[model samples]
Target: MTPSTSTNLTRIVKFGKKPAKRDARNLKLSAILKAPPRLPAEYDFDVQHNGIPTPMFGNDYHGDCVIAGRAHQTLRFEDAEQKKILPITETDVLKEWHLENGGTEDGVYVLDSIKLWRTKGWKAAGKVYKIKAFAEIDRKNHDEVKSTVYADIGTGLGFSLPDSAMTEFNAGKPWALTTKPPNKKNGHYVYVPGYTKIGPVCVTWGRKQQMNWAFFDKYCDEAYAMIDAADTKKKKSILDGKKIDEFLTKLKK
Candidate 1:
């Protein structure tokens, strides 16, 4: 479905395949295993902004996911209807606007650049302005009845949903709980999208460590190589779970 944007809305977001894949990679998996997991992992990017990294949406043109925070602060009211706000009807057109202004025409936050506009002072004018959004990994709570039986069957403990799964998981679906958009299970975040069920399967009975270790074992060589060969200190930080969260959180803010 297309996104419906009104004066009250701030961002537009959607999920779909892209002819060109995003560049997300799983260096952790590649490090131990010889093979490199798919580039862009499972998510696409297509956010419209000046210099910000947006999702690279596919030709399908699915509606964009409206970023729901500060983007709304920039809404413009129509002169004809003071009580009602204008809606951005076209994703492409809205994207165009997002590129020009710091925000999307639909009001999605798409800043061209992030800079500390102010160097000092205590006034609002001295403060820097930037938009930040973040998604914490969480899993759906399973029934106690099933948990006991499948305690080892599913050890839901992962930082975030594979980027591929975030779209459907984020949609207003039965599984995507309203209170927790990404849902949480145990200590890990879980989002069981339709796509996660496909591609590959392996039998295992270990706990979370076992699962991650097994998965990474298959592509350890590639994952480690990416880490070792990383030229910049910035890239190396991705390997550290804490650093990844810090980076993502900073971007969201």
Candidate 2:
């Protein structure tokens, strides 16, 4: 397809509730979607330099792709989270998930978490992901604002792409895939490490996955990228997982 064509940016990650003011995020991403894509390349989320490597974390069966995805994003930078980048454990992801939802088997929801964290400066399920310090990469009217949660790339600490889905970019490969009937396990929220010759590279489950321009055209629905704000800190909020189950139960009444 040519660079001017528009593609759907819808998603498959389920949310019990919907989000607000998603127009700007979606519209900006649509333009990105229309941009020309590069081709024939490989990406490693580990950020290797010639041979040296950086470690990353993976997900578990209980549905923590969102957490794993966020963790991988942090590992992309040398000093993400205001400290040295390290492999963020799935347990770290799970612990924060508990704090956010009280550990009630909520799985992962991209829209609600992203809008709150990326645009409104709320904490991600994992405390390590401080949306407060990160800025939204793109917005419809970003320059008009004097001071805002979102900013240009140079100023933001790290950016996040919200409301995207994981679809099968290639068939019969080790790479994960999401289809129209959408594989239940494949649907996910991923961290955009950056673009590649193929298209955008998402760090998912501790590995790099490519969504080429054509793949994005067919499966990509919505997205937002958060950039680092001017300030950066390694401090992370902490939460206890054991109490999460009990806390959520108490709220039911």
- lDDT top scorer: 2
Q: Write the per-residue lDDT of candidate 1 for residues 1-253, one digit (tens) a residue.
A: 1222111132232321111111243212222222222332221111111122112221113222221111121111111113333232334333433443345222221111111111110111122223221111111211211121111111112221233222322332222212232211111111111112111111101100112222322221110010112222423333333544455455557
User: After best superposition, candidate 1 residue 244: deviation in angstroms?
Assistant: 30
The number of the candidate with the highest TM-score is 2
Q: lDDT scores for all predictions?
A: 0.21, 0.37
Candidate 2 ranges beyond 4 A from true positions: 1-58, 77-83, 115-129, 133-186, 230-253
Report lDDT (Cα) of residue 177, candidate 2.
32
TM-scores for candidates 1 onward, in order: 0.20, 0.50
CA error at residue 245 for candidate 2, angstroms: 37
How would you encode candidate 2's per-residue C-alpha lDDT over 9-80 as one tens digit per residue?
532222221112244323232222211222225333334322222223324334445555555544444343
Query: What TM-score would you give candidate 2 relative to the actual structure?
Result: 0.50
Cα deviation in Å at residue 212, candidate 1? 24
